[model samples]
Target: MAFTVSANFAISADGKISSDPQRPSGWTSSQDHKRLLELRRNADAIIVGRGTLCADNMSLTVPDQTPQPLRCVVSRKGNFNGNEKIFHSHGGDIHLLVTNAISCDFERDSVTLHFANLTDFIETLHRDHGVKHIHCEGGGMLLRALLDYDLLDTLHLTWAAHTLFGGTNAPTISGLDDGIFFSSRHFSLVEMIESGAEGELFLTYQRNDAAK
Candidate 1:
């Protein structure tokens, strides 16, 4: 409740964010990249699942913006290689949120580590760190957790017609183990930008909580 959480992703017409064996989403257009950067520039913090960091080596950069947004990575086990680019590439602080279920020590001067569940983590981000807006660039599992917790307020999706990544192992935004956990959540279209002649659609949806 302390922060407005937004999730963003690009998917193929078949509803796959990745191809076989969890391939990196390198096929997305430059336009999508620009939009991602724009979101980063406007937010107070950026979040990514640990799987996304492992798969894409993301830096979460906010170039040309003063007081760069904090980069946060969430992991259940607090597991990470110290040499990843996310550690060395950003100009702002990097934090790790490892659940109290994890007993592993993840403390260092280079990064601040917090032990909290997702709910407590959001409160801490708002109260202690003064973060009001958070944008999540996902790897699916994290998106499901936010949705199930009723923490997500908005979603940005891009539908690409030319690409078809059809694989059983591929993931969409919410790959919940228990299907329909978010059946009560409702979202309405807020905006749509159709790319000219490419059959590409950039869509924004906001959860309709105020309506009901």
Candidate 2:
């Protein structure tokens, strides 16, 4: 089985995913809030980087929705705090993907840990869990790794012009290193919707091959 990844994010006009000084995505318009829930509704699983999990403290729950998608977290070092809401959520499965380069001493009945490469990790989602469509909410680094490897298939972006989080170190949807580039991993616009009169945009992008 082949699994496709779609990333969702709301960003400031400055192209920062979140505030440079550390702020969650709650600063966006209410339209984006609805968009996010709708995105989650369509996904078979929702994935986030460990940085995002810690920074945002996401609830990872879908209300009034049957068969909630799996809540997945990825970490290079496998560092985590068990107090996260995802761990204690009432329904759905919690999964953690840890890389082979690090050691993760943490374990819990609520969380299933996968120690594998990125490719294998994704394959297991489709083969073992039957996750056909994956929604990724990122902290830049994880998304960067996916995009750099041509693993990302789509992007759902919300551009909020009213906000600005200024800092050179601030991250965007992708947090690639200074010299890395994936020229072939291009995305074409699948849809664009203007959100009222707030100078906000809801844009959808699919890979050049997948846009059809």
Candidate 3:
């Protein structure tokens, strides 16, 4: 069976994910953080880019939650120090999807899977691991790959209008650099809520198969 994919991001008014490529998104409100955990509750696994993993120092573990979801990270080269917070946290089994040919040595129980590309890894997750729903908390580049493959089924966005990360190099949901997908993908808004007090808008979109 094919698994469903969803992603969540906190975008700024200027459509930037962060002011700097290495900066963590600490500007978002507590409400936004709460929503992130809420989304994790529905996921069978959480996938993130290595840059996001490191930048946020993410544990990838849902707090006080049972049957913790698998934490997966993707990187071109598996060059991670064993010091990432995910390694020390008590979460579900960790899986590393290395998309390039490289050898990594880390003394940890994490399982490393080598794949030629992101699409292969995503397919293998459903085929081998019984992953029915995968959620992504991204740092842009990984989200771009999902959009490139047209595999993302749902998108949840926290539009924080009070902040602006206004740099040409700042990334949107796609990435830091300028590029276009092979084809335009369309989405239909499923839900929209405005948090006037927080100056944020919560938006949920579902893939529009008929449109694109």
**Against the true structure, what is each candidate's TM-score?**
0.92, 0.91, 0.94
- For model 3, the superposed segments whose C-alpha errors exceed 4 Å read 210-212
lDDT string for model 3 (11-95, tens) is: 9989999887787876388889889999999999999999999989999999998999999999888888888899989998888
Worst ten in a row by lDDT for model 1 = 100-109
In angstroms, the error of model 2 at 40 is: 0.6
How many steric clashes between backbone atoms does each model show?
0, 0, 0
- Please give, for residues 49-167, the per-residue lDDT of candidate 2 as tens digits: 88788778787778899899999888887877688767766757888999855557888997889988777888898898899998898878888877766888889999887888767
lDDT (C-alpha, whole model) for all candidates: 0.81, 0.81, 0.86
Better of 2 and 3 by TM-score: 3
Q: What TM-score does model 3 achieve against the real structure?
A: 0.94
Q: Tell how far residue 161 is off in model 2, in angstroms.
A: 1.5
Q: Which stretches of candidate 2 lie over 4 Å from their true place?
A: 101-103, 176-178, 210-212
Q: Which lDDT value does model 1 have at 156?
A: 92
- Give the C-alpha lDDT of model 1: 0.81
Clashing residue pairs found in predicted model 2: none
What C-alpha lDDT, on a 0 to 100 scale, does residue 46 get in candidate 2? 90
